[model samples]
Target: MSETNDTGTAAPAPVSNWNVPNALTTLRIVMVPFYGWALLVDGGDSVAWRCVAWFIFGVAMITDKVDGDIARKRNLITNFGKIADPIADKAITGMAFIGLAIIIDTWWMWAITVVVLVREWTVTLLRLSILKRVVVPAAQSGKVKTAAQAVGLGLLTLPLLEVDGWLDVPGEVVYGFALVILGIAVVLTITSGYEFFREVWRQRHEIREKSPERRK
Candidate 1:
């Protein structure tokens, strides 16, 4: 699901301040390829590729912030963004985590990666199903999940931050810390996903009760 701008106006001009949010989204989309290249084609573990991947990851993270700010400040939040933004985020984070899991040879990393991806994928369908009955707004827990995922992903990418002639932390500590935090993040991610689904169900039931068609 991609993040959408909620500019409520029905007939927004083709070019508006809203462009900032879309531009940032586009930037993130563009970075995915470069990030993939840095990891797969360029020898992700090497210093040169590490810098490229790190930069791409950093920029992707930054755009997550930038797009939100632009949407809220400009009142350009749209349903499209609400849907696409999260999808875009999942795609990028999923790639990074999966790549690291493969490279590091950690089975737990893959497990966490799968858990996170499942949460993301599940919520989209869950929300869509509930949207038929009631409007489902983003919840606080959902936001927290996104933040946690970002932190976990950033930490996981530390190995890719390696640079020649630069100090590298001991592998044990880095992976250990990342694993712990990612585990916590996965817990939160799943919990939030469940909560979101519960909220949707409750709202949908409420809507049904109020609808006259239900009386028949």
Candidate 2:
């Protein structure tokens, strides 16, 4: 049975929150603190602890992908998913970047992390401000940025040299590779931020032109 308005027009149905995708999103948010604990529990020095942290990070990232796929495939998308999903992604990855910066104790890492965080939060706020009027779905560049961040963080989370030298690779070599990936991530972050702002500006202009006051 559908409810009708006073004019006898059918009312729109409410978006459901109790869905698989939403549950996954909530789980991802819940895991952020545990992920942080795993990363920082041993000052990021212990090989075992670092491994645990990497595993947790990996799982969280997987959930990010899974939830999105499920939402799209099952037609379970909702306003809450749209807002909460990105926040979950940022929180987990942001925690990783911060933990890595602190653990590595390097000026460059800290600087990169700060720049990325600032861009992420700024764009997030911009999106939220116009969320009701516009739905800015994730772009390809944004996905690349996320992938680069996850790979870089995963590599950095490992205790490379401390692990058994069965692979016979130097720690410096592995670290350098991670740094390169993170640098790419940083570039993509900036570029995508610019794209988001450009879109937001266009949207605002469209809204203004369509306004009844503007017509008069």
Highest lDDT among the candidates is held by which one? Answer: 2
Taken over the whole model, the C-alpha lDDT of each candidate is: 0.72, 0.87
Error of 1 at 104 (Å): 2.2
TM-score of 2: 0.88
lDDT of 2 at 40: 85
Model 1 lDDT tens row, 1-216: 333457744554443435678778877877787786676544456656755676788889899898989798978877667666766777788788777767666777678778877878777766555476566687787777777777766766655245323345465466567677677778888888887778878987888898899988
Distance from true position, residue 45, model 1, in Å?
A: 2.5
Model 1 misses residue 53 by how many Å? 0.9
Q: Put down candidate 2 lDDT per residue, 1-216, tens digits, no spaces.
A: 888889999987776999999999999999889888888876877878888888888888899999999998978999999889889988998999899888988998899989999999888876766457876777899889989999988898887756656643777689889989989999999999888878878987899999999999
Models 1 onward score TM values of 0.80, 0.88
For each predicted model, how many residue pairs clash, with residues at least 3 apart or on different chains?
A: 20, 0
List clashing residue pairs in candidate 2.
none
